[model samples]
Target: MTTTPDITLRSRLTTDCELHLPGDPGYDTARLAWNLAVAQRPAAVALPRTPEEVADVVRAAADAGLRVAPQTTGHGAAALGEQDLDDVVLVKLAALTGATVDPTARTARVLGGTQWQEVVEAAAPYGLTALHGSAPDVGVAGYLLGGGLSFYGRSHGVAVNSVRAAEVVTADGALVRASATENADLFWAVRGGGGNLGVVVALEIDLLPYAEVYAGMLLWDRERAPEVLPAWVEWSRTAPESATTSLRVMSFPPLPELPPFLSGRDLIIIDGAILETDADADAVLAPLRALGPEMDTFARVPAAALTQVHMDPPVPSPAVADHSVLGPLDDEAVATLLAQVGPGTRSGLMFAELRHLGGAFARPAAGGGVLASIAGDYALLCLAMAPTPEAVVAGKAAAFSVVRAMAPWAQASLVPTFAETRVDASRFYGDEEWERLLRIRAEVDPHRVFVANHAL
Candidate 1:
């Protein structure tokens, strides 16, 4: 007689999700990401197709005495530590990709597995777009779970704020919906809670009636940072909620892939943003543009040109990535940083970005949102390549110093994607929310089935 399989989480996941164990040929490559410093291999990689399948995989992992590591295109591929990674199921939901748009309501249905680029491309046809993180390849699930900020943050709000509903699979291998009406508290936690509760299957988010945006950058010389950095800050204070901006002080690799102006040089970049309107982008950019640029790539482009914001390399590279939120940018500190890591320093640091904050971002989500509580984030992104331990240490020190100098303005939140060491779960969650997450975990995943490689 044929035997029935166990319907618990593990039984459902055993086969439905693609499993790539250590001996698999592409396992090493699959376990890495755009950022090279972070990479790791779990006992197996589970590519789940649906919520039921994901639930099944988790149950199967539990049955097999394995922990689950959730992964999206955006996660650090190599940061897992040896102490906790002996036997784990790396959950990859890349197969659950696709998005549908509703132009009339300015909304779209996003599969938790879909990447930001997919949504950008899908919404273009309807003259509507989802304000997503800088990189198109960043997954929607991680972005939303991490309290997603976007290009349209000034005009709209975090990607989590735009979410109307979610379809999720609880730890028990049960599929359910979380909206205003059902599982309301769980929905609130997911908004800014950083996925501590459960895995989301699909997200229905509100879309903006955005067509073409005055989206592009204003490149300046490193010398201009003294003049431009603070100017951007001053400009931010008076900036209408309509415009969004960011300043980046970075060193370009001496690779042929870079343009002549930006190649082998330390440069400062200003990403100027605004909605699709008759507003003259140049007018807003004039203050920064006035400082002068050794090279400039600024221009009005289609919103789908998402890569331009971070200018993150399309091809993965061997590099180290880390970041911190700046509370403020003092002139002396800015000067010290420019002198140390900018143009002539030849510091081997790839990019240092300063994402402009305030505007709508400063406003807390009214009822609550599911995400790590990120109160204020004046983030500084530092990317570097460390061929030696000494170089890595130096780069880390330099990056930290910058953040330390700017710490006066740091909000209590951190982007988990950038965590290199230590994840204080309490810092990621507010009092009630943090307690609520633990309670949910106890009720749903009593075995502590999920543990993030980078802390909450």
Candidate 2:
């Protein structure tokens, strides 16, 4: 049975903001996410312009005996199951895309709805940069909340550590500030915790002093995998904290939308950024250079260009992704991965990646949030196109098999953003951390008024 929205609540929400029901003209468009596979169906959708407006919307939902779930860009929508979103008020904050940088303070105050691309452009002129994700179009709030893993992470730390403050509208319809000093508990809970405590409207984050860097991709045919893949792994063992890199094996189908170099090709690519000079990058990449990759694009580029170095899809596409954080990769683990998704496996996966993890990422901050460091030293992400429900199931199974083969080395906990599929709380937090998260959630949201894509 469909729950009809309370008319009084709907009226209040629509007075200053937008309120769209299932049958409304723009409801479908408002509910669409970056991943085209999941079709979102909420009881109602609201787009609030300001923090006060967001609080009002939450109050309205509370008054109507409904819960609230917020989405900035919906890049990680797979975690929101239909049951969790049912009778939930979906708050889309696309209108709150505002950002200001304090060049002297080396900080940026970004509205929740803002994307990384906006912040990169704004900070570039000042010679400062945020700990942005691989995709320029990814929303700042969602990425930061999930303890973002940035191209700069190996040098700096997880993006959450850079957060100075978060302006949040809590379940009680009260607007509050969360930081090291103010609303301290909420501050601790939100950094690595998913958006379960409340809706974040704005964030104050520390910026890095980086104007340019050496960054790009190197590609090789799959036939060279046996030699090249292991060589990259061995070289990564001695790589410095100044560099961040990942290796990906991809099969791109013929499509007019794809770039000529990538379309209808099966290739292995190494992509990353070295914070220092070109000489430093060349020295670090010397081992791989001996193999002579078919294509190499490494060069000194603006730091903003790091956002697209991984070549993440620039548009919405139908796909499913699975993840696993694993122990250090050895010859055995590398061979196991190849047996499942390599050239002749017919794995059906579009791409499989292994990100080298260590450096600042392995150390805990003085007063870090819930996730101090990922338990393992490397992370694997496998994705496949799923054009239909059946394809989604098959694709997910094939991708998971690769992870299962490496299960012995898999970490017990997952990096929040990496758990793109519908995973339970255990997959993201340790037993103690999980209980602490629940206690904090209950204390702040007694009525459980807010629901995140991945609930604790």
Model 1 regions more than 4 Å off: 1-16, 77-83, 294-299, 370-374, 386-398, 408-412, 417-421, 454-456
Number of the top-ranking candidate, with TM-score as the measure: 2
lDDT of 1 by residue, 1-456 (tens): 112222233344555566666768867766665555544656777788876678887667666667777777634543454225557667777878889998888888888788888898999888777868777787888778777668788767666788888887765657789888898877776676544556777889888776667777777777666677777776766667777777777776687978787787667777756764545666666666677765556666676775456676665555555566656656665666666565456655667677766677667666656452344536666767755667667766766665565565565666554444455656655677677776766765676666664433
- Against the true structure, candidate 2 has what lDDT? 0.85
Score residue 225 of candidate 2 by CA lDDT: 82
Return the TM-score for each candidate structure.
Answer: 0.88, 0.96
Model 1: lowest-lDDT 10 consecutive positions:
1-10
Query: How well does candidate 2 match the true structure in TM-score terms?
Result: 0.96
Q: Scored by CA lDDT, what does every candidate get?
A: 0.67, 0.85
Clashing pairs in 2: none
